[model samples]
Target: MRTTTRMLALFAVPALTVTGCGLFTDETTEKMTDVANSFADALNADDPAAAGAVTTDPPRAADTIGTLYEGLGKDAHFEVTGVDKDAGTFTLDATWKFGKDGHNEWKYTTTGKVDDTGDGWKVGWDAATVAPGLDAGPLTYSAVYPEASRVLASDGELMTQQVVTVVNVSPGADLAAVANLIGPISPGITAPSLQSDLTAVQGKPITAITLRETDIAPIETQLAALANVTLSPQTRLLTVEKELASPTLAGLAQLWQSDADAAAGWAVRAQTAQGTQRLAGRDPEPTTDIRTTLDLGWQRAAESALAPITQPATIVAIAPSTGNVVAMAQNSAADTQGPIALTGLYPPGSTFKTVTVSAALQAGTVTPDSIVACPGSANIEGRVIPNDNNFELGNVPLHTAFARSCNTTMGRLAVDLPPEALTDAAAQLGLGIDYVTPGLTTVTGSVPAADTPALRVEEGIGQGKVTASPFGMAMVAASLAHGSAPNPTLVAGQPGTPDRTPPALPATIADQVKTMMRETITDGTATQIRDIPGLLGKTGTAEFIDDTHAHGWFVGISGDLAFAVFVHDANSSGPAVEAAGRMLRAR
Candidate 1:
C-alpha cells in the first residue's frame, strides 16, 4: 500500500510540471501580442516615435519608421497581422500611396520579431519591418516629361511650339552687363534681380529666364559671346510668330500649361547601390493636339491693318453666322492699355445708335421710314444734343436719321421709351453679360438707368453712363446679321455658353436696324467705307469730356465677318473708319 501511494505522488508531480510549462507559454504569447498590437496602433496613427517606444532600439526604430513614411511620399500606413507570440514573431502589412490620387496603394508584407525584455515584451527593430527591402537605402521622387504638344490654327498651321533656352550667368558676373545684353531680347530682365539670383547661387551658375526658341535666336550669338554667360536650349511651348503675342493668343498659351505638365510623368523610386527600383506611379499618357478657331489669315490681316495706326487701336473680327472670333489684333500703343480689344470700357458713341434704333423699333416708336425731325441741336432736360460736327439734315425718315447719326433726333426717340428700354435692348444684343468660357476673358459693357430726360438724352447718343467693349460692339453687329445674338466662341470644343439664356431679338427689329446700318454705310456717317461690297457700319466720335479729345469708334459687318475697331483719343471718327476700310479691304 505504501509503494502504490508513492507511485501516485510521482505521477501527480509530472502532471503539475506539465501544467506549469503550458501556463508560462500562454502568458508569454499574450504579452508579446499586446506589444505588437500597441506598436501597430502607433504606426497606424502616424506616430513613429510612439511605435519606437515598444521596440528594443527605440531611437533607431523611430528613425527607420519615419524614413519609410517620407520615402513613400508621406502616404503610408501599416497593420499588424498573424501574431505568433510563442515564436516571438508578427506579420506586418504596409501600404504606400504615391500617386496624386490616394487610389494607388502598393501593399506588401514583412516580418517583425518580438523579444522578452527584463520587465516587458518589446519588438526587435529592423528597417525591413517598416518596408520590405527598405533596409538597403532611401527612395526619391522624379518627373520624366514627354515632348510637349504644339498649338495649331484652324487650317492646321502651327501657331506655337515648346522651346526652352536657359540663360545661365556665372557667379560674380557683371549683372548690369548681363541686363544690357539680355534686356533688349526680353523685357522685365532687371540688373538687381539678376545679381540677386547670382549671389544666391554662391559661385554656381544661375539660370535666367527660359525663352521661346524663336525669341532666343536673335540673342543666341550675343549670349554665347558673353564671358560668364551660357545658353542652354531645351524644348518648351511658345508662340511661333511674335505678332501673335497679343492677349488672345497669350490666353491660349496659358491654357496649354496643364496639358504639358500632365504629359510629364511622375515616379517614386528607391535608389540603392545595386540599382534603382520603381516603387509607384506610371508614365504619363500620350499627348493630343489642341485645335483653335483662330483664322491665321484674318489675324495677320487685322494686325497689318492696325500696324500703320500709331495711336492706341484694337480690332476684333468674328464670323457673324457661327460667332467664331477669327481675328483679334491690338497695336503696341493699345497693348500698353492691356487687352483693350476684349476688355476696354468706352462709350460706343454713335455705334450704340444701333441699339437705340432696335429699342425704338421694338417699342413701336418708329419704323425704318417713319419721318423724324433732325435739327442742328435740341434742348432736352436743360441739355443740348447734336449730331457729329453739329450738322443736321432736317426732317428725314427714321432710317436717314439713324444713318446720319442724328443725336438730337435719337434723343427725342429714346425719351419716348422707358428707362430700361436701351439696357434691355443691349442685353438682347449680347451685351451686359459675362461669358464663362475657358481661356477667354471679356468685360461685357454696361448700360445704367436713364431716370431723367438729361440722362436719357445722353444715353441715346451713347454718351452718359453707357459703355461697350470692342467685343461687345462686334456682337451687336453680329446680332443684326444673325437676326439674334450668337454666343461667341474661341476654342473649337469649348463654346462659351452663357449662364442665363439671352432673349432673342425680334426679327422685325433686327431687320430694320440692319437696313439703317446698310444705309449708314451707303450714304451717311460711314459712307467713306461704302466702296467695300456689302459693307454696313456706324461711325462714333465719343466725347469723353467737354474740352478734351473724343475717342474714334466703328462697328461694321461685311459678308460673314462682323468687326469693331477703336482708336483712343482720336479727334474724329475718321481714323477708326479708315482702319475699318483697311481691314475690310484686306479681308
Candidate 2:
C-alpha cells in the first residue's frame, strides 16, 4: 500500500493498517556505524583481511554485506549519512559510491558490535545478513529452470522488479567451473576450486536466489558464483550488509561488478540497515521506492507491531506544505479492480461536500452562514437525496451543515447550482481527467461526466458515480489547508521546485471550506479527530453498491504533513476515525 495510494487501496477486503513515528534506534547504534565505516575503509584500502578483522562474534562470513568486500578493493568508495548508536551496538549509515552514474548510490546499514571483549572495543559485521552458518554445502543456481523477479521503484531506491539476466550452468559444473564462469561478472567473489567446498545438484549442486518477497530481482549469471551455494533450506534469515571472506564471495562480487542481479542486490541493500527475516520465492518486488518519505522506524515498526491487530488499510501520508508522500501502504490481499482509489467509481459520501460548497460559493449561491433547510432528505429536481444525520434539525447555516455532513443541504445546494459550475470546479481540482504527470496519476474518480439532477445531487454528497484517490483527497485537504491548490508530490530527493496549480476555487471559498473542515472535528461527525492537538479534518461514509457500513474515510493535515486515508470495506466508520486519530495524535 505504501507503493502508491491506489496500489494499496484495501477496497473490498479492509484494513492493512500502518503506524507512523520518528527515526529509528536499537542496541548497537554507533558500533554498527563504526564497523560499517571500518569495513568501508578496509575495502578502500584493499584489505579484505583487515575488513574481516573487525567483524563481531557470530561473524557474518558469507552474507550480502560480507561479499561486498570479498574480491574488489579500492574500486568502491563510501558516503556516510546520519548514524545512531545504541548501548552495545551501532548502526553505520552509508552508501556505496561505485561506478560513474552507473548507479546513483546504494544505501545500506551495517550492524556491528563493540562488546567489551575486555580488550578495548571490538566490532564486526553481524551474522544475520551473512548466514555464515553454512552446511559447507556448495551454493548453486537452478539453471535448468532459472527465474528471477525484478523490483522497480519510482522513488529511486535502486530496487528492481524485473528480470535482468539468466544463467545456464553445466549439468554438474564443479565449484571451480562455477567460480571461473562468473569471475568476470562481478568484483565480489572468487572462482571455485577443484577441491570440495561447493554443493552438488543432481550431482549438479543447483540452488536458487529469490528477491521476490522484498521487491528485488534474482538472476543466475548475475549470481553465477553463488549459483551452487546452499545453506540449510530451513534457515530464514537475511541481513542488510556483509562482513565475510570467501572465494565464493569473490565470485558473487565478480558477477555483481558487471551482471545486473548481483550488482543491484548489493546496491539496494547497501544503504539499508542490517535486517534478518524470512524471504519467500516469487516474482521480484515491484520497482518502486522501498525507502519512502516514511520514517523507516515507523514502517518497520508498523509491519512488526501492527501485523498482530490491524488488517490492511490503505494508508497515504504526505507533507502538506510540499506534498511529499511520506508513506503509502495497501494491505489488501490482492487487487480486484474493486473500489481502488484512482479507478473505482463509488460515492464520495459527505467528503464531497467541500466540493459542493466550492460549487455553491463559486456560483454565488451560498456563504458560510447561508441558512439552508435540513429536512433529513431533500428532493432535488425530482431525485431524493437524504441526510444520514437525520435529526430534522430545521434550517441551519451552510458551514454547520457541512461540518455535520448533512446530505440534504449539499444535495439542495447542488440541485440549485449551475451544473457547469460544479463540473468546472471538479475539473479545476483535477478530476474526470488523466493526471499522469510524473509522481502521481489521476484516475478520473468519477467526476460528474454529465448533467443529471440525481447525479448532481449525489455529487454534492460525494455519492453516486463520484469517487476519488487518496492522493486526490489529500490534495483537497492541502488545498483547503493552505488556501491554495497544491499538487501532491512524492519526496524523491528534495523539492528542488514545484509546479504551480492554479487555485481550484476563489481564495475565500477555499478558506471557508477549511473552516468547515476544522469545525468538523470541533462540532461534527468527526469528533474523534478532536483528540489530537491542532487538527483540521473531514470524515466520510461512502455508500457503494454491494455492501454496508459506508466505507470510512478521513483526510487531515498537521505539522508540515498532509495525509488522507480510507478504511475501505470496513464494519463501521470507527476504524477510519481511528486511522485519522492515529495521524492526529502523533505530535
Candidate 3:
C-alpha cells in the first residue's frame, strides 16, 4: 500500500504542473536564461543584427534595435537582470551614455518575453522590449546648448551674439546680380571674383559673405528675391561697435563657444503620436560670462590714433599697476600682416636703449649723472654705432644722453657691460621672456646674450639680433612704471605663466629709468608732443632693410598706463611719437 501511494503522489505532481510551471524543467529554464543572456551580450557589444538573430523575428528586431541604438547616441549597454520561466519573461537593465565624451548616462530596467515557439527559446520581438513605452514612436537624442555668453571688457560688453545674414549663391545663380547687390555693402565682392570663386568650387553653393545685421537689413529683401540666392540669418559673436575690429576678438569668440559647449544640456527623447516626450538628460546650465582685461575706452582711443596712418601700425597698452592688458588696436594695414601687434618681431631700435641703459646701471657701469661721450659715430670692436643723423654730444650726463637717444653713448655703455647683462636686464623688464598668457599669443622681444663687444654695441643701440613686438615693448615700459615687471594678463583671473622667473628690477634703477624717460618728453627727441601731461617716453627708429627706411617706435608711460606704439617702415621715430601723443591725449 505504501509503494502504491508514493508512485501515485509523483504522478499527481507531474500532472498538476504539466501545463504551466511544470513544463519548464531545469533544462528548459537554463535555455531560457541563456537566450536572454545571449541577447544582452549582443546588445552590449553594439551588434544589433546579432542581438536580433536570437529574437523571434530577426529583420524587424534588428532594424528597430539599430534605430534605437543610434538614436540613443550609439553608446547603449544592456544587462540581463532576471528570467521568469513561469511568465516567459526576462528583466533587463539598459544604460545609454550620451555626449562627445559619454559623460552622461540614462539607465532604466525593461522587461521582455521569451518563448520556445515550437523551436528553440527566443526573445519576443517588440520595441517595448528595448525600452518602456518605446513602441510609441521613433527615438532621438539631442543637445540643447545654452546661449553663448557675452565677452565683457573692463567697462562693458565687448562682444555679444547677434544675427548676421549669410549670402549663398547656388549653382547656375546669376553671379552678376549677386555681386552687384552685395558689392556695395561687402568689400571685395565683385562679379568676376564671384564667378572665379564659384567656378573653383565646382559650381557648388558658394557662401559669398556674412554681413552684420545693420549692413544686411537694407538689402535682405533684394538678396532673397534673386533666384538661387539664400539669405540665412545666423547668430554670431560680434563686437559691440561695428568699427571695432581686432585679432583678439577671434580668440575671445573661440573661448565663448567652448564655454557654451561645455555647459550644454542633453536629452534622450521620442517623437510620439501624442507629442515629443523627454526620456532622460538634464536641462542646460547657464554659461558664465567671459571677462577680459581690455578697456573699451582705451581700445577706441588706440584705434582712432592709428586710423589715419596708412602704414602697418599698432598700439598695445597695459595697466602698469596690475599688468592687465587695457587695449590692443591694429589698423587695417596692420591687420593684413596678422596679429603683428602681439607677435610680429621687429628690431626695437632705439626703444631697446631702455634695456641697454638698465643693464648699464645694474652692472655699475654708469650712474645717471655720470658724464659720457656721445659722439655722432663711434667704432666699437669693428662695429660702427651712430646716433640718428650723426648727432653728437661731446660729453654729457648719462640721463641727458638717454633723453636724446644718443646711440653712440648707449653703445659705449653696453660694450663696457657683461655679455649677459643686457639679456638679464631685458628679462627683468619682461622682454626676452616667454609668457603663456591666456587669450593671447605673444612673442615678447628676444635679447640674446651679446657675447662680443660689437654685438653688445649693436644691441645697446637696439640694432642687430634684437627684436620685439609692440606688446613686448609695452611690457618694458610697464616694468619701469610698476617698479617691477608685472605678470602680464589678458583674461581676468588668468595671469600669465612665465617660463622662467627673472630677478626683480631694483626700485632705484626703475626710478632712474623713469626719470630719463620723463626727460625725453620734457627736453629731448620726443618733445614735439610733450604737452600731454605726466608723459614719459622713449622714441626709436629701427633700421630694417636699410638705413634709409626704418620702423618707428615709442614706448611710454602716462599716469597708470603704459603703452607702445609701432609704425612699420615709418623712416623715423616721429610717427610713433605722434601716434603716442594722440593716444594719450584721447585718453
Q: Which stretches of candidate 3 lie over 4 Å from their true place?
A: 1-72, 115-123, 131-134, 273-275, 545-549
Candidate 3, residues 68-89: lDDT per residue as tens digits?
8767756878888898878989
Q: Against the true structure, what is each candidate's TM-score?
A: 0.81, 0.51, 0.87
lDDT of 1 by residue, 280-351 (tens): 666776777778778888888888888888999999888888888888889999999899999999988889
lDDT at position 429, candidate 2: 53
Best of the two (1, 2) by TM-score:
1
The per-residue C-alpha lDDT of model 2 at residue 336 equals 32
Q: Each prediction's Cα RMSD?
A: 4.7, 28.3, 4.1
164-246: candidate 2 lDDT, tens digit per residue: 23233433445455455454444333444322323343345433223322222232333444544432212121222121111
Per-model CA lDDT versus the true structure: 0.82, 0.52, 0.89
Residue 422 CA displacement from its true place in model 1, Å:
1.6
Error of 3 at 179 (Å): 2.2
